[model samples]
Target: MNTITRLFDFPYHQLEKYNLSDSLVTKYGNDWIKTSTEEYLDKANAISRSLVRLGVNKDDKIALISSSNRTEWHICDIGILQTGAQNVPIYPTITSEDYEYILNHSESIYCFISDSEVFEKINAIRKNVPTLKEIYSFNEVEGCKNWKELLTLGEDKDNQNIVEERKNSIATTDLATIIYTSGTTGRPKGVMLTHQNIVSDVLMSAVRVPLRAGDTRALSFLPICHIFERMLIYLYQYYGISIYFAESIEKISDNLKEVHPHVMSVVPRLLEKVYDKIYAKGDALTGIKKKLFFWALALGMDYKPYGENGAWYEFKLKIARKLIFSKWQEGLGGELELLVCGSAALQTRLSKVFCAANIPVMEGYGLTETSPVISVNDMRNGGFRVGSVGKVIDGVKVKIAEDGEILCQGPNVMIGYYKDETQTNDVIKDGYFHTGDIGEIDQDGFLKITDRKKEMFKTSGGKYIAPQVLENTFKQSRFIDQIMVIGDGEKMPAAFIQPNFDFLKEWGSRKKIAIGSTNKEIVSNEKVISRIQEEVDASNANFGNWEKIKRFELTPDIWSIEAGHLTPTMKLKRKIIKEIYKDLYHKIYS
Candidate 1:
């Protein structure tokens, strides 16, 4: 509403408003080459025009299946908007079953696939989707329309006007995108977010983080298909921040070195893995270097920020930053100012560890329903607090129900689940969206999320247990990679652990135990079992009796996308695991 409505109407059009001439670079090998934002926009416009030429009209749905990238993928996203069509992005790693369901369910008229490999999968199942009309592959493939060729169709002036007509007709309340939730429990439901929902988020997030023009730059990697990443795309554009797309997750370290981006957003799983990598590397250091690393880590824990009246702690923290944290900074390409984390609860220890390292890791909390952000720690305003998702963002009203469920009412909240009116009314009651998250507010107004209402379970002893809280605590232990606390409608909670097998394998070799063995053999070994048990026991001490994990079992293979144990977002599919491993649970309890 700032009166700058001419260049583009959609959220993706925000790119044209700011630094259209600035460098928008994507990674290639070790090089960071610049491509003008205008050039990127022109390509997008061409695609948009082409879609119009293909007879795509307002309110049409276009499916986008791809991974995180900087260049062409972004163009396709913008093109979807320019045509006044809804973008339905599916994860590149999505299962064939889900892919078929999403395509057929959404009635997508067209789809843009990332590469030939992805195109092949869709082509195999394309016949199943009766509504799908055209297929465009980002990378060239046989028998498919190339992405560049599609752009040529829009080059005609008449085609361009059709796209413009569609854009002019779009209302603020019109659906901008349909993001299907990759739920850990059930079939994925498409969440309909409007232009208003995302626009509100862009403004509110800026209020909390202050991504001022020319001051902030973001390195995008988290799948833009998810609300958490998608919302930030709008935020970055609205504030005129430079947006750089990372080449891949593997190249983040290198990309950070090159871009030195001030801000980035990620989930807890990625952060934990990065922290683990740093720890693993730190273990290789010897003598003073190793001792210094631990000393710096401890120093970070003790360092208190300014305005907290901890003068003594602040002074000590400064010395620690100089001595121990400086090297840690160097490893991260040295210029990270703030990291906004969401999707799952970040381990408090991880947040503190990064903060101690002089990089402010601000943890935030929200679901896809609330445009994915309601609260986040404000680094500039308040000292980042551990175990809290900061204060709620401005313009968002939060109230805790008598049952302790968190309810949020704001423009940022989604309109409702697409095509599911029953669910829509059931969750959004009396102008408030029931977040289904339990939380409490402190005197300082920082929100501490306690548990998920749906994920909580009761033990056979009639004691209530919240698995998420316990899982966060358990993850603090480096030995445990991922855990699912299960004892639902049972006597007591137990866990199915996916151990840090690499760490265990290394330990076995070091101790001269049977090293070259299968995962089952290694896990069953007395030494490995004892080591895992010690960590589990330590975690259990903080939990109430029935909530404590008892008699855990370990699986050798890593639970991964290929195995379907985890979603593309890396969240465990609990019900799937429960069904697959029912025998394992029965064996432990019976």
Candidate 2:
């Protein structure tokens, strides 16, 4: 329990302290496959030995691309790190061009993949990536080598001493992983994080995560390529909590029923989807059932932390929990103790309602460069505050700049962006990492993010607008699914909305209104336009006249990652969105 310094030390710490029989679980077909801590270490060590045999050196880069998280990724992670190579976890959804760019940038010597799709992507770019020596797949692909072969090569124990030597030689400050930032603009930059950068983060952030330790189970579905989920993986291992990987995002509902996980990490986009599904279910009810559902929901929307609403509110909340919210708990597998929301700004409505439903949704804030945890809302004590990311975690210092950027200085800060001192220096100045996020620390020290500094824009009239804050608040409307506030060099601020089509269709049927099926049809429907206008007008009340959305257009398509309108993390690729919706943009400002 004591001497944990490096990333690999986490599993070893678990092996000694808990030695869990089900440290990592992944679903394959109908079976819930398990990899014990003993097996996890054994396979990792074997991969280490095999990599050594292949002449893999310290600081050598190895890239991993997985369609979804699996036990092999974790095993490969430990195995790769123990061999003193840096793991470059790449998003599976990105194009082959991105793969080639990151591989060449990191100078990755070996690449491990998940399936045939990923194998084909890498195979297509193999000629361009001359540094890549071999490709190994977790799932057997037709022409690709399987990872088991690498493990087979390391099955021999004689080279165990070499792995031990490599493990010992790896310092706490040594580079552990080279995470390529999902830059909305330009090529992705490699953010080089150290063992200390993450180890310190996991340890400090651990106090904020509520867990009973070894026995509790966690369901991990967030892209582990991102430090937010990757860091949580190490934290789960540190506490010996069993981690169950969902099959994929498409199958999360089924997996939730089977796993009944006590905890999971989520992004705001997922919460939006969950809320929509839950809202649709509620709307499907009839007569008094619908009335009761809405009454409970209305009570939920007025939620405040620590009983600030007094005894009467708590009594109604108790009834709401039994009559309404208990089903929300049951839908996500009757046993969700905590759902840590991160990666983007979560709508305050989502946080408030989820909390009122007896679902603890703690919002956290950080970046891949911070080794990812700067602050997180916790349920214990007075640690939580509504609409805030949460109190800053222990061992990290946060101070707002005069212009309102959240600057932080702490052990969790990254070593630097790999091979790019100029870009790194721009952000990390005077030992403080300028988060590029504008926020203010409240009197009680809860961090409330306003918007991304780079994203905030000044209109032609010199009126400044923070779109993300507006977007977050407006998304609280059940009708508006996604929105982008615009007016960068224009007369007034406006928006492009992607309405909650699911909710719209249900309401359409209920009201005997034909809102249509296709996105174009629904968006053009006069009734639908008027309804959305009402929601927009309502949300505009919270903003200044200059900042308020003056006129808005609805999109005929969802802004998504694959469509190139959104980044993988679900943040609006403002430039990309504008390019695609230029016609709509002109319609508003013309």
Candidate 3:
């Protein structure tokens, strides 16, 4: 059980012993900000000294509210850790009330905000949080202290010894971070994680998928507040890979081309969007090019990764690769070797299409409480099973409970939920953390998640339906952008559908159907409904009569994080969706 103390100590030692400097580059606007390893270490040490001068001590909690992924974010995080204080990350998208709750609960003394907007969020609730002493803004603010002031405060050379002593005094078991889960069910609970929990995951995951220094470049777009990306930042530094942060969510595609990164981690929603864009482009092609594009796509979707296809299928695949798939790779900046997808189950059809096009998508599964890397597909050895989240990482053990819930045991598991022993006990029992995800391990050691235990519901006929499974199946249709199956306490299943507007527009022109501009009119149109019914019927053909969706309601409104229908990671907030569409659900049942 090695700890992150050694991991944290490496940068300084690299500066002193190996003369390693200016290796990390972060993107700011159109310019790249390059910081030497030594420079970063010095700045972090200075910030640490400043915090001590501000009366911050070991075990104190410091909160950060930021949407940007500048080098300063990493420096502040390491600086807080160097002082043996815990870092509490707050999502910038969260409401002011959530900020108050987390800051008050953690008793954070100092808060760092990325911009004025974030500062305003904290400022609104600053009076409510009695423990908060100061708010530092990374960007210039009229009333708030800028983050650079800390460096000026720490200029005294005498504080160097104090910084070193504090770093050495911190133990691996000491709390390093307290990440609050973005609750779908209730109030957000802070999951306490030690250096041991996170470092073990980084080390084990590195062993599973070896990322080399000087060879791997990563473009980061996922929020640093997320454990998935936070852990990845450490892994990138450990492997000596240069990381380029995208300016914003909208700039990811442009950044990917400019960075030409070797590897990237993304949520499935982004991947889905990429596929949708590609499909839209394919649909826009004409004549021979259009026919060939679709033919290649069909062949790609039927591709078998393990070479299980017949000679005829293999022959067509080679032609598809040459004629169409190579363009897909080129479109993704021509250097992407591995695309790591998580945060939700990727549609298996989409997975096959990408892999078939030589763009390997490695889907993994984990939770924030596990320091996020539980299992990931092995890209090097071809250990990928299309629908399965690859083998559990080294040093982690997983088992299926009698009720089919996935239970995990590893050093990577969190210590407990902060100040909630009862809630912690409910999940962790006899050293195994109950994941609350229903899954089973195959003979090949791949784990396939069936559904969320809480999400699976039984109909009035006693037949259980996994909404995710049904939704995923329906989403394979080109016309469907999103689908949510509903059948709780009902005789059969129904769905709320969001049509793919691009596909529908093209379809409408081809069929001479007048699609209304408004969502209500579009959904109520007989022609649109009939087309959606066709797709639903095709999807239902694969399921039993009890499992099939008998009716559906279409919506024109897109689900988005800003709209409160989706989480930051783009996962549907099911309870919120159910509540918002209660009338629609009743209409389907009626």
Taken over the whole model, the C-alpha lDDT of each candidate is 0.79, 0.92, 0.85
Better of 1 and 3 by lDDT: 3
The candidate with the higher lDDT, 2 or 3, is 2
**All candidates in order of lDDT, best leading:** 2, 3, 1
lDDT of 1 at 191: 86
Model 2 agreement with the true structure over 212-254: per-residue lDDT tens digits: 7988999999888989999999999988899999998899999
Clashing pairs in 3: 22-36
Q: Per-residue alpha-carbon lDDT of model 3 for 1-590, expressed as tens digits?
A: 12245336545544544333444677765688888777888888889999988889999999988886777888899889999999999888987888899999999999999998898888999999999999998889989999999988987768778888988898878899999986544778999999989988888887766566645678887889999988888877776677777788888777878888888888888888888899889988999999999999998878777677988888888899899998888888788888888899998988899988888888999999999888999766767888999999989999999999999999999999999998899999999999989999998899999999988999999999998888888887888988888889999889888888778878888888898767677878889899889999999999998999999998778877877788888888888888888899889988
Model 3 bad stretches (over 4 Å): 1-7, 10-23, 310-316
Among all windows of 10 consecutive residues in model 3, the one with the lowest summed lDDT is: 1-10
lDDT of model 1 at position 391:
92
- Clashes in model 2: which pairs? none
